[model samples]
Target: MTIQIIVLATNEKADAVIKQGSLAQMPSLQDGWRFDFRKQLKALKHATAYILVREDSPEVIEGCLIFQLVDKMVPYMAFVEVAPHNKGDEKKHDHVAGCLIAYAFKQSLIRGSGRL
Candidate 1:
């Protein structure tokens, strides 16, 4: 299935991300880094959330990422994860992580940060 990326800007969308089937399935603590998505997501002032949806099914989220616009010029991606089914060699989709990074780059440019 094709993937569509969108910036989450509403409570409805936020709720969807929280209720997604893979939400609880994802690691509560990031490996090697120890960041908490649940806690981090709550602090919206520090980061923006972006999600990837399966084109054929809006309810099916392929991935999600947390990024911050720092100094009003730098956009930093703090956390990212693909749906469990989309990880590893038998992954359901390709470049899910790359898509999020690209979106982050787009945000940086939009904020007048120029080329990264």
Candidate 2:
């Protein structure tokens, strides 16, 4: 299975941060914090999942979520948001994000579920 992730930026600032390809890279939120998108794929490549990003602002992370489709048919999803000023929040955000993505996919399979 092949999954595609498209990064969306409102302006040049966010645009500049993104690199091209199946493994597009971007800088982390904190100064000097960087990670390669390739590494993320290496971790998830075995799974039947893909990511599509819509970057509005760092604030969007507060409302970001993930969705997944299995065998191009069954859909599952979940909802998630970030908690401000918490050390463990990042992990929580990731978990919720994954769930939200699955939720969105599942909802898409239903009739008249509307946009996620």
Candidate 3:
């Protein structure tokens, strides 16, 4: 499912999308990402992954999210990372982390129905 999100472009708020990510589209450290996302995905076997990309440039990922339900109850956010361009003061986008976090919370409400 596509979720609406916002990104920064020339200091303006632009539309983006958050959706389920597949192994084929996974990013790696070599791709200018801080973490080796492929390795993280391998290590977090039970987690579900998601990616944030610009609406006009789906090919350029802005961030990634890895999450899962802990013991089938509590929602646990295992990992989250934004592209190098989305980090620090020179960041190209805004709300990259917030959008991923909000997505996790939404998942918790939808899929994590059990109590911890």
The global C-alpha lDDT for each of the candidates, from Candidate 1 onward, is 0.57, 0.31, 0.81
Which regions of candidate 2 deviate over 4 angstroms? 1-60, 78-107, 110-116
Predicted structure 1, TM vs. truth: 0.61
Best by TM-score: 3
Worst 10 residues of 2 by lDDT: 11-20
Q: Residue 57 in model 1: shift from native, Å? A: 1.1
TM-score of each: 0.61, 0.28, 0.86
Q: Candidate 1: where is the Cα deviation over 4 Å?
A: 1-36, 112-116
User: For residue 87, what is the lDDT in candidate 2?
Assistant: 19
lDDT of model 3 at position 35: 74
Per-residue lDDT over 11-105 for candidate 2, one digit per residue giving the tens place of the 0 to 100 score: 12221111122333322335122332233334542222223233443222222322333344444332223223211523212233333354455
Give the lDDT of residue 69 in candidate 1: 70
Error of 2 at 13 (Å): 26
Choose 1 or 3, whichever is better by lDDT.
3
Better of 2 and 3 by TM-score: 3
Task: For candidate 2, give the lDDT of residue 34.
Answer: 30
Rank candidates, lDDT, best first: 3, 1, 2
The C-alpha stretches of model 3 lying farther than 4 A from their native spots are 1-9
Could you tell me the TM-score of candidate 2?
A: 0.28
In model 2, how large is the Cα lDDT of residue 98? 39
Q: Per-residue lDDT of 1-116 in model 3, one digit per residue for the tens? A: 45554444555676788898997788997888877777888777467889999888999988898887766677889889888888887778878888899899898888886666
